[model samples]
Each structure stands twice: as C-alpha cells, then as structure tokens.
Target chain A: MSAHLTEIIVFSVLFLLVSGMGFVAAKWRAPTDMAHLDEWGLGGRSFGGWITWFLVGGDLYTAYTFVAVPALIFGAGAAGFFAVPYTVVIYPLFFLILVRLWSVSHRHGFVTPADFVRTRYDSPTLALLIAITGIVATMPYIALQLIGIEAVLKTMGVTGDSAIARHLPIIIAFAILAAYTYQSGLRAPALIAFVKDTLIYIVIIVAVIYLPYKLGGWGAIFEAADKKFQASPAPGDGIILNANNQVQYFTLALGSALALFLYPHSITGVLASRNRDVIKRNMSALPAYSFLLGLIALLGYMAIAAGVKPLPGAKPGSVDSNTVVPLLFDLHFPPWFAGVAFAAIGIGALVPAAIMSIAAANLFTRNIYKEYLRKDATPAQEAGVAKITSLVVKIGAVAFIVFLDPQFSIDLQLIGGVIILQTGPSVILGLYGRWLHRGALIAGWAAGMGLAFWMLWQIPNAATGRKHFGGSAFALSEFGFDTPKTIYVGFVAVLVNLAVAVLVTFLLRALKTPEGVDGTAKDDYFADEGDPRIARRLPGTVEKVSST
Target chain B: MAEPESPHADTKPRTDSSPWNWLLLVPIVVPLLTPLFNHDEPRLAGFPLFYWLQFAFILLGVVTTTLVYRMTRSRGRS
Candidate 1:
C-alpha cells in the first residue's frame, strides 16, 4: 500500500493540533500553586465527571491496547482477544477497588498505592518493594506505547532505514511528550484524551461498518479468517478456542483483570478524579470501550477478508503484524481518513505514555526519594523530583525500545502483568482487612515475584524462537506434572504468592510476629469528599503529618 | 469465613455492610468458573457460544455492577 501525500498531511496537521493542546494544557486548569505534588502529579485532584471519564478511558486504553491488541489478533487468531474478557472483567474489578482507593487516598492524603501500602502495612521495606515493582512494570508499558507510535510511523512511510534514523521519529515524539508532561503533568494527557477518544471512536465505528461492507459482511469476514487460519499449520490459532487454549484464555483474562488496577498508572488516574462518584460512574461506563475493543479485534478478520497484506515491496515475514489495521485503512479508506486513524493511534500512544511516565515518577518521588533520600524534602522539592523523574522514566522507556527488539518489550509487558498481579494480594486485600501478616506479605511478594519471573523465563515462543520470556503462557509440567496444557503465568504466580502469604501468615501468628501498626482507621477506607473525617486539604499543601 | 483474631490496634467492631457487596465479585468470578460453560454448542447469531457468551456475561456484569451501585448509591458516595 502506498502512503498518500494527503494522508501524510492530514496526520501531521492533526498530530500538531494534539501537540498544541498538550502544551496549552498547562494553563487550562491554572492551579494557583504549582509547587506541590498534588497539583503537578495528580492534576490538583479536581477532575470532574467528563474530564475523569476521558482521562481514565485514555489512560487505560493505551496505544498498546489499540495497536497491539488488534495486531495480536491479526497474528494469533482467537487468543489475542483474551484482551476482551480481561477488559470486561477489569471494569467490575475497578468498580470495586478504585472507589475505596479514592476515598482512602482522599482521607489520608495518599498519592500512590505504595504510599497506601507503606501506611497500611507500616513497612517501608514492603512499600519500597511495591514502589520498585510499579516503576519496573511501568517501564515496559511505556515502551509499548513507543512501539505503537513506531508502527504508525512505519505505516506512514515516515521511518528511516538505519537504527538511529528509524527511531528518530519516536525520539522526537517522546521529546514533545516529555516537554508537555513536564509542564502540565497529568492535565496534559487528560485534555488531549478528549480528541484521542473521539477520533478512535469515529475510526472504529466507520471501520466496523464500512470495511465489512467493502469485504462482503461479518459472515464473510469470519469465514475468510477461518479459512486463513485453517490454511496455517499452527495449532490453536483459529476463530474459536479449543480444549488446549481454553485454559490459557480463561486464566489470562482472570489474571489480567486482577492485575489491571494494580498498576500505578491506573491508580494514578483514579486518584486524579474529583470524587468517588466519578470513579464509580467510569467503572460502569468503561465497558463501552470493551465493546469497541471487540469491534477493533474483528478488524483482524476484516483485513483477512479484504486480502490486505503488507506494503508491495517489503520482504516476506518482514511485515510487522501491528501494521495490519493501519494498512487495512490505507488500502480501503481515502487518504485523509487514514491519516485521521493514524493520528488516533499516535495520540493514543502519547496519552498513556504521559500517564505511565507520570505514575512511575510519582512512585519514585513519593516512595523512594522522599521516604528514603530526604525525609524533610519540601513540597516544591517533591514535585521537582517527580518532574525530573518522569523525564528520566521516559528516557528509560526510549532506551528500552531503541536498544532491545520491540518484541522483547512485548514479552516484558507479559512479564509485567505477572509482576503487577503479585501486588494485588497485598494492595487489594489490605484495602479491606489487615489479615495477612507483614512478614507474610514480604514472603508472599517475594514468592510471587520470583515465581512470575521464573515462570515467564520458562515459557518459549514458536514465532520468535526464544526459549525464555517468550510470552505469557507457560507449560503446566513446570510443576513436574505432565498435562498437555498451558496457563497464564500471572495466574499461577499469584496462586503461589497467595499460598506463601497464607502459610507465612499462619507461621507468623504462631511465632507472634507483629503485623505492623495500621496507620489508617477502619472508617478511612470508606470516607468520601463530603465526609467530615477526610478533611479537604488545600490544593498545594503537602502532608501536614510528618509521616506522609 | 474464619475471622482470625487480630491483636492489633483499632478494632472498632466492623459492621456488616450489605449482602450486595458480595455481588460485586460475581463479574470477577464468572470467568474463573469456566467449566460451567466453555463449550461452543450454542452459537448466538453466527457467533460461537465461546465468543458471544463472553459478551453476554460482560453485559451481565455491567448490569450487576449498576444494580449494586444503585442499591448502595447513598452509602457508596454522594
């Protein structure tokens, strides 16, 4: 497919418009004070219904989910739609956990989950572990957003041949992203999300209707996809799941739902909402995106039906599967509309990249920098540190993409889901009851982290031909039992984590080891904006208490 | 459920919130109990049971959450 000049022009204009919005977002909210983490990091905690809706939508549905989800479906038929049930389950999961996190964070002036983890369990070591995990897990996700942008750029013919030249566009994109995020913080992404979501919805709706018409119909689309998969020699790559992959499909969905909220970026978005009601409303409404995702996944089949392939002169097997949707658009739609869709994918990457970097930065500033490095750091110092850290995190993500194969970043994201899921047993469980002993939690987290890494390290990919860290699925025989099946690594790791946590809890109880002081009151978990208990702090104030 | 006696501070005798709170977990649990309905027999409108059923369950989850949110609306947050 040829990249038309009109497509290039339209994509540039729309992207420039988004960049302008990102820069202008610094003054949009106009916080009276910019010298506090509350303003710079959390957007003054003042986003209302509409803003929070767009923000959370943009935050969760990243370029990775947009480009990568459809790409995965295009590459590996039904299993890639594992994202569907996961997305469906995640809203309900967020519906239950986020409101409580919002309420408690408001009550105790908590900014990050690590902060809550620090206070709830009163173990800086455990909090340190959680904070480090958040930062580490978020790095690959930011790399994923870069992968999204790179794919769009490649399809646009904007890429250069050499390594440095090929990545120059990504570097430039991320530089603008870093600059705007440094100036406006979370508000930058929140403002641009309105445009991103609208473009994505428009593109998806049009594609779902127009493309299927061009390629006969949905029946024909699925038939073509089934025929293509049937021609392939791979096992478990079809329009439907079989007995072998059913276990993997189910476990991946369940584990991902459990892990989605554990990421600091997701929690950061939730905490930025004006109140608990925003969180509640968004949870119910976010499922609308799941329906959209389902439609997007079908684009894979549409591409098959339309017989769309990579660009004319590209080498065989050199085609990045991520370009399927973009190429499909380039082949089917007019140049201008294809540009609009490319901008949506590009901006989709930008919004989540900003949020993920910001969240990672928040974790570093609050948990590591202030807690350990400078107990007496001022509010301005904290925000300053966070701002610088966000840039550094972006730089790290850039290095991850530029140095390693982008496929490794994808595998790392699978490993990240496994890593992040381990935090659920502590963060989610700690929100309700403080039953697990602190020592036990340490053991649990260790076991979970270790098992997740080990399990991911054991799995191999047939497509990539890597022995370890290949993808999210692992053999059941890793436990020395022969079963002709694979399961989500996160699910098994979490089970191991939970088992160790429970066992250690019992051992600690028998040994009379203290489960540190619960810094928060029982009522604090449920406190809302109007509640007398959660005194509304002024916008720019750091914690009044020394502990934070 | 065995409530392990916690010898920690701030034991304020927790009040039972509502039975509906447990219903929030239904959506999360539905996928795990896949043995109940993992087959592809009953296709809905040319979509396999394995596929469309997930969408149905997702709608069911959304409805369940909306119900719980409405019932506990006053209690959750104003």
Candidate 2:
C-alpha cells in the first residue's frame, strides 16, 4: 500500500541473508577449538593476503566513512573532505606501521596493542590505560554506526514519532549483530565484510555516475555547492579552504591518519592476517578503498544538487547532516534500488560494529581482566570473558543510541580522536624505539587525556545547543589569537602528549628510574610470514586455508 | 653486523639493518607534515589543490612502499 514498503522488504531480505551468513561464518575456515583468543578473537589469525585485504578494508571504511564523511561534507563543505586525505595517508602509514605490528604480534602472539604495551613497557597500569581508552573510544564509534543505520531507517520512513517505535529496528539489528558476534567473534565480520564492501562499491559507483546525470553535470553540481556556501553566513562554509581553516584541515587529516590505525578494532583486522607479507600486500591494495572514499565524498555535493533537504518540521539549525546520503538515495533511486543502498549502509554498519566490539572485548580479556582480575584465566576462560565483554560492549554502544542524541555520539567520536591520539607516544613511537620510559608514558597519557577533555570542554556549537564539549574545532581565538584560525584539538593534545613524554623520559632516565626490561628481540619487528618459530604456534596440523 | 650481541636478535629477519629500511619513513613523514601542501590553488578539473594532491600522494606512497618491499625482499631477511 505504501511506496517505502518495497524498500523495507528488500532491505529486510538482505539483512536476513547477512544474518544467516553471520551464523555460518563461525565454521568458515573452521578452527578445531575456538577456545583461545587467537582462535576466536582474531579469526585464528590465519587469513592470507586477499582475505586480509578485504577484512581490513571493510573494517576501516566503515559506516562513518560511508555516512558521516559525506554527511560532514554536506554540512561543513570542503572540510568534510578531510576524511579523504586521512584515508589516503592511512594506507602509507599502514604499509609501514602495520607489517611491523603484524611481525611483533605474530612473534609474541600479542592480540591487542595493550598486550604489546604491557610487555614492551612492563607496565600494567599503562596497558590498562590503553585498554580503557580503546574501549571508550570504540563505544561511541559503534554508536555512530547505529546513526548510519538510523539515517537509513529515517529515509525509508520506518521511524515513527514515538521513541520506542523509532529505536525498535535498531534494537533488532544490534540483537542480530550481538548474537552472531557472541557466537562467531571476529569471523562474523571477516566473512560479512566481503558482502558489505561489494554492496558499498556497487552503490557508490552507480550513485556517483548516475546521480550527476540525474541532476545536470559535475559543473552544475559544483556551481550549486558554491552558490549554497556563498549564500550561507557561516564562516569557512565555502567550497574552498581559507587560510584560517587550512591548518585545521591539514592537522585533522594528519592527526586522524595517525589515530585511525591505533584504534583497537583497526589493529585487530591487521593482526588477523596470516603473516607480515599479507599485511604489506593488503596495505597497497587497501588504498583502493581510499579511491572509493574520494568518490563517496562527492555524494554530499550530489545531495545538494538534488535539492534534498531535512525532513519537514525538522529544525534547520539542528538539521541532521547524517540523513543527506540516505535522503539522496531515497529521492533518486527506484524503491528497490534504494533498498539496496540502505542495506549497503546497514550492513556497512554491521561489519565495523562487530569488529569494534570484538576488539574492545579482546582488550578487556587480555589486558584488563586477565592482567588484573584473573591472572590465571585459561585460554577458554579468556575467550569466554571476551565473548561476554563483546556482548557488554555492544550493549554500551546501543545505550548511546537509546539514551543520547546521535549528534552527541558524533561529538564523542571527535573526543575519541583526541583521546586515542594520546597512545601514539607509547604505541606508534614505541614500535620504532623503546627510548621513552614507562613512567614517562603514563604521565604523557594523563596529560594528553586531561588536555583533550579541557579542549573539548571549551568548544561551543551554538546551533547544537552545546555550551561546552560541543565539537572538535578548537578556535585559536580561544587562546587569545587575533586571527580566526582553528586547529584540530587532537593534534594539539597529541603534541602536548609527545612533549611530556620526551621531557619526563629524560627526567626519569637522569634520575635512573628502573626502566623495565623490553621483552622483544630487536629483529622481532621485522619478522616475515614463513618464519618457522612463529609458524609453529599455529594450530597443530590445521592446514592453512586461503579462503577469502 | 646488527648488534647480534642481543641473544634473540638473529631469530627473525635482519631487514631492519639493511640501508633501505630507512625508506619506510618517507611514506609516513611526507604525509604527516600538513603545512607542506595545504593550499587550494591550481584546481584540477574543479577539484582543489588540497584534494587532488592527496590522491597523487596515495599513488606515490603505494609505489614507494611496494618498491621498498621488493628491494628489501631480495637483499635482506637472512
């Protein structure tokens, strides 16, 4: 009877099909016993080159990339393009940083960055801080995925005026995701990523090519964007970058590129590969998604061209930018095809949300629960805890949806960027050298975390009705500068983190504070796939399956 | 040659001691320095300089990293 029903039916069928795949994925490349963190938490860490490529690609180019990147572009204009450079730079950084992490991880069988931190710095307190930051950073990220799903539902007209009616579909989606994740762990996402990525690619290619023709041309699209921005009274809303905002764009991209891989879920994808060479090959191949992302960012401009606006009676000042892409699809594509696009967004959220929950769970099981609560957790017990923790983490993410506005979760993500960047001095820099003292790293993390919150507390978005901790853009004028320049709070906070790390390190060294022994060999950072020592740790007599 | 004095050092690849490993820094450092290429002039096909150069940098990074992987694969790991 209704036009949106065809979309609802198509989306439901695909979501059901993927849920079926999620259940069956537990047996994909089946391990003999899925009782260990390596086996359950990381898909046995046996994925070869192509599989790793899709898995990591699927994990990084998330619902955020699909929804928020375009949404931000639609809302903020060119600054939304920051995600593009961040991802472009991410591949190169991944090429360099990931293989080493893979090598060291494979050698020591380290599952989380906190595991590496504990052994590298021999500081449980420091590892605990890292683990907690990862869990906190990721919960809001998982919430953003719900926002993607919500935007899709909103466009599909499934959302009702009542709160319970609105959140019903989200609850169902997360329930399916949570059950499968609890059953399958990382395998669920690893298997579903193939479908998610394929749908995203098809939807994007078709939309990018087809949408421009539907409107006028690229020239017309650009002109419309320029006209809108030129008419808007807000500063820095134009199609081009001004001097005041260039530094913010640059630093945001650069800072986010560094922060991207440090998130536990991202590293989980990397560490799941069979070996270092798999990581290297995947690094080169993953940039192809960045190419896809560049095309996806253009969706925002297309939405503007299509004259898509927020829903009727929606506040103009508090317009949901997240709705732009789905609204674009709903208006232009046929109902069934729009359904396909919505499924793409919905499943896109599923893959990352699954993996993020798993990563957070692993950090708790190995670094927090196992390290502190139960030093004697068996492999089975550890996996058990991680499974339960994964469920708990998913529940926490869902709470973000049920309790707060979706925009609040988005702001949490920016704060997440600021907080996770604090780990760089200890994690990324430590991968190259161990010169920074453990006590110094602890001090640095506290300083970075403190400054990140303080900076966040200072940003006020008047439109969103936030007086403090409103967004990521820190006004340079806040620091008494004459100009209108703003910087990424994450970048400045990270700089403070590094400075404190260096200074405290020298002081600790001069005072001769007992720097704990480094547990790793210098050569461990360069280990490759066929290294016999590491290979022996693989499940005995289980043949390496090259399944994608 | 690589301070094999550390007892466990020889257990894994010696690729780090090779001269070419330093090249990995190029892909990382070039992209991290934002002020180096943060302009919007000379728009390519209506895309700003800030946008198009990043795609080129991605290409450059992949090539350099692939080259490093090839060069190091042949000469080191013993």
What is each candidate's DockQ, to 2 decimals? 0.25, 0.30
Q: Write the per-residue lDDT of candidate 1 for residues A126-172, one digit (tens) a residue.
A: 99999999999999999999988887788888887778998998998
Q: Model 2: per-residue lDDT, tens digit, A1-548?
A: 27799999999999999999999999999988787788889998899987887888889988888788887777778877877778767776787677788887877779999988887888989999999998999999999899889988888888877778888999999999999999998999989989989998999999978988878877688778888998888788867666788788878888888888799999999999887777777766777898888888879988888898965323344677788888899889999999999999999999999999999999999898888898866677888999999999988998888888776445678778788989988899889989999999999999999999998999998657778988888999988888799999999998998899899999999999999988777777877676655546445332232111
Evaluate residue A329 in candidate 1 and report its C-alpha lDDT on the 0 to 100 scale. 87
Report how far residue A452 has shifted in candidate 1, in Å.
Answer: 1.4
Candidate 1 chain A: minimum summed lDDT over ten consecutive residues — where?
A310-319
lDDT score, candidate 1, position A524? 67
**CA-based DockQ, model 2:** 0.30
For candidate 1, give the lDDT of residue A253. Answer: 85
RMSD (Cα, Å) for all candidates, in order, is 4.1, 4.1
TM-score of 2: 0.94
CA displacement after TM-score superposition, residue A93 of candidate 2 (Å): 1.5
lDDT score of residue A381 within candidate 1:
84
**Steric clash pairs (candidate 1):** none
